[model samples]
Target: MKVVIIGAGVAGLSIGWRLLQAGATVTILDRAQPAHGATWAAAGMLAVTAELEGAHAAERDLALHANALWPGFASEVEQASGVPVGFVRSGALLLAPDAAALDAMRARGPVLDAAGARALVPLLADGIAGGLWAADEAHVDNRRLGEAMTIAYVKAGGALVPQTAAVRIEQKSGAAVCVLTPRHRYHADAFVIAAGAWSGLLGDIPITPVKGEMIALAPPAGAQLPGPVIWGNGVYLVPRDEGGQKLLLVGATMQEAGFDTSLSPDVRDQLRAGAQSLIPALKQWVLADHWAGLRPKSPDGLPLLGPVRSGNIFVASGQFRNGILLAPAIAQLMADMVLGKTKIIPAFDPQRFAPRFV
Candidate 1:
């Protein structure tokens, strides 16, 4: 089968890889370089248990299932691309700043006393009342992962066309037949719109861009910010180990700022304060980088998957914050649905928002 996927972000690249592996001819089109969107700026937290507060049962189940697939998926991508994506199973620490917050964390899962939490994360602030430890949580270097997926897709004989903006899906006889770009029209047997926030622009899907800003910090010489992803005070501190460098990703300020990717000094300062409150030693760390990206969010906060009006045209976007964590499973599900092996989950069905689509 010939498949053309729009958007070369993690979702698109992942689906492309799976389809190509299944012997389908694949082409991925992107308006910019691959992984240059939310995938690039994500903190890469695969926190299945840590991020389930507002999630429904199906969403939680999907997250857990996706987290379970990460180990093997990471290995497969690494083997296929001959590149290390830095998949880390370093667990996660959820810290509460006060008694009320501590009680909330306790209600969620197994929590530790202040002493215990500090034991695990030595850099934790003394004022922390208590928290939880999610041992199964993990993270990956998303940029590296994106690069690996791109390599894997190409090595598996998939095509990637960057700088190509897919303006619309061309349908004939009630079936998607081609995609129209400014310069040319590309035909394929199947089309998947995995364009992140831009997915709504194609065919009136109700996906919106939630902007998030983040900062990266380099640990001071001979001192390391220890243990698991740290979640405290509306921010997360994710440690990144890349090429013998120990860096921390401090983020993020979530806002309904549309497609704007601008960085604000006030937001950066707020993030810095959050980080220092979690790890005081971070005060000495160097401010390395800061940026923003737009997360494609659905109204219900779950991904939109499965076919639209056109059977062969599918929607696999609206991953929001968990896009990096959910890439492998989302890809597998999308590939299966496209190949007629499985049906879309009702909760995540694109038709759930049918009124908006119409």
Candidate 2:
């Protein structure tokens, strides 16, 4: 079977990798170089427990399953590519620096506690009044992971077409035939639409673009910030394995504005200052690098996965804030569905957004 995966982000590479394992001939198409989009800017924090708070039961279960698969998946990819994905089991710290935040955190402690929080993270200071230790969760060096995925995809007999913009997906006889590119066309038995924020741009997808800005900083003079991911009031401070350069991935403001990845000083300063409020240790980390990416978002805050109304057209976008965390399981499910193994995740099916299909 010749499977064509559009967009070479983590979702695309993961799908291609799985399809290759299933003995499918895979071809990946991307507008830019593989993994250059949101995957490049991701913090690589696989902190499911940390993100589980206030999430619906279904969402939490999905996150937990994905996190569980990560260790084995990372190990397999490392063995195949001979490069570590930098999986960190240090756990995530959810600190509450103020009274209101502390109160809210305490309310959600039981859910995180059940996810092995206490065993995974550090105990907080007494006066701080609130914290959760999500122990089973982990983090990864996303940059290396992206590179490894793309490398492994190509090395496994998969074809990669860089700088090829997929202009449109043409559905005929209720099945996807071939995607239109700038200068050529390639037919496929199956098609996976895993384009990040661009998922909705494909004519009928319901996904939207939510802008996210992140900054990397050199750790304080004392050394690295020892943790998986630090989530306080307004920021997510994720540490990088590269020496003491910590990634201050902060202020994921949910904006409906279309595809503006350029970082604003206002957003940057606000994010940096927000991190300072969370972990006081951040007051010393020197600014290192800054970037922004668009998240595939939706009004309902749920990812649009599963099949499209048209045949051979599947979606795995609208992940919103859980794109990185959901990568493994989403790809696995996509492969399973493509192989006719089981019913896809029902809620995420694109049919949900279709008035007639409903």
Candidate 3:
């Protein structure tokens, strides 16, 4: 089958690679450089329990399944592309401000006293009353993953067209037959919109761009960085080793601003303050970098992973913040669905918000 995917982010690239492995000819088109969108901008936290504590049962199960698939997926990508994606299972620490919040956090993981938490991360502020240690949590280098996926997809014989923005889908007899672009028309047996925050702009996918800003911090000389991800103060500090240079990535301010990726000074300061609230010693850390990316959010805040009203056209978007963590599962699921090997998940049906999309 001939398949054309819009959006060359992680989702699109992974799905394309999967389809190629399944003997389908696939072409991925992107508005800019592939994976430079949310895929590159993510913190790469595989926080199944930490991030999905209050999530719905289905979403929780999906997250767990995705988490389980990550190790194998990372290995496969690295072997295929000959690039390291920095998949780490270092776990995470979730700090609670008080006893009540700590009580509520027990269900997420093993409860830890203040001293116990500080033992794991000595730099933790003294004010932390207690915390949860989630051993199942992990993280990846999302930027590296994107680059590796791009190389793997191309190596797998899939066509990847960069800077080629798909303008619209042309449907015939209630089935998508062509994608109209500025320079050329891409005709295919199937079309998939995995365009991250830009999915809704292409068609009626009902995705909105939620802007997030993040900052990279380098610890002061001779100071130790947190061994694992620290979640607290409305932000997360993810430790990364970029070519032996240790850095802590503190993130993410969610704004409903549309498609604006400009960095915010106020947001940067706020992130630093939040990180410092969790780890006091960070005050001496140098701010290495600050940037932003837009997350594709749905009205129900769940992924849309099925065919639209137009039969042959499908959607694998609305992943929001979990895009990196969910990439492996989504790629397999979407590929199976496209190949008629699996069924569409009802809760994640693209047409769930009916009239709004059609």
Candidate 4:
């Protein structure tokens, strides 16, 4: 099977790796550097239990499956590429400082806690109201994972054509024939449109962007937060490496913003204020960087996966906030489906978004 995957980010690269392992010819085409998009910017929180809210049932299961695969997948990638993805099992702290925040956090207890109602994370700042401690879920250094996956995919004999963006998906005889790029027309036995936020703009389907603003903070000298990833409503912090450098990633303002990825200082400050309030330890941390990513989010919050009505072209996007968390499992399911194997999750199938009743 010859597969041409669009977008060389986590979703595309991981799937390419699987397909190549299955003795398939894989070529990944991207408009920019591999994994440099949202993948590079993501905080790499693999916390399925911590990152859930009023998400769809299908989305929850898909995220859970992907979260389960990260440990083994991380080991395999590190072995293949000689690079550690900074995978951490340090668990997570769902902390809420005040009454309002604690109320919201407490509401999630029924879903994340073992008992009918209880606090998960053990410690409290005396006034720390309530939260969940997800010991099984954690995070990865996404930057390392992206770089590692690129190396792994290449070592697995996958061809990567960076800076090559597909202009459109061309159809012939009621099926996708070739992906028309500005420089050349590339055809393959199959095509997987894993083009992140740009997947919907492929002229075949309605893919939209969900803007997520993030900030990175490395704490000052002789100061360190706990090892667990901490979340308090809108603000969350994940420690980077074995130091005080904790990357603060938050602010998932879900508006129907088109593809405008420019960062808003107002939004950044608002996020910073919220994070500092939750983790007062964040007050000493200096802001390292700020950026925004337009995550591909669908109407139902579930990713659009499986073959499209355009034929021969599969859609693997609309990951929304869970793009980083869902990468590994989504790749496995898509790769298997493309190779005549059983899909890892059926609800992600693109047919669910078909126009007839979508």
lDDT of each prediction vs. the true structure?
0.89, 0.76, 0.91, 0.77
- Expressed as tens digits, the lDDT of each residue in 36-67 for candidate 3 is 99999999999897779678787887899999
Point out where model 1 deviates above 4 Å.
355-358
Colliding pairs, model 1: none
Give candidates' CA RMSD values in order.
Answer: 1.4, 3.7, 1.2, 3.8
Name the weakest run of 10 consecutive residues (lDDT summed) in model 4.
113-122
- Residue 275's lDDT within candidate 3 is 93
Q: Per-residue lDDT tens digits of candidate 2, residues 1-358?
A: 8888889999999988999899888899999999988888777878687766677677778888998898888988888787778888867767655556656766554334322433343432224544565667688887888888988888888899999988887767777888889998879988888888997777677777877778877765656455667676667777676533445455455556788777788877887887776555667778887887888876678787777777587787887778888889988888888777768676677778861111
Model 3 residue 126 lDDT score: 84
| lDDT of each residue in 1-358, candidate 1, tens digit only | 9999999999999999999889899999999999888889899999887778778888888899999999999999999999899998998988888878888777677888899888888777788987888989999999899899989999999999999999988877788889999998999999999999889998879899999999999977798757689998889999899879878999888899878898899999999998888888888999999999999999988899999876888999899888988898999999999999998899999988871332
The alpha-carbon deviation from the true structure for residue 222 of candidate 4, after best TM-score superposition, in angstroms, is 0.9
Q: TM-scores for all candidates? A: 0.97, 0.90, 0.98, 0.89
Best candidate according to TM-score: 3
lDDT of 4 by residue, 200-236 (tens): 7675466778777888777677665457777765677
Task: Report the lDDT of model 1 for residue 104.
Answer: 79
State which candidate, 2 or 3, has the greater TM-score. 3
Steric overlap count per candidate: 0, 3, 0, 2
lDDT over C-alpha atoms for residue 241 of model 1: 90
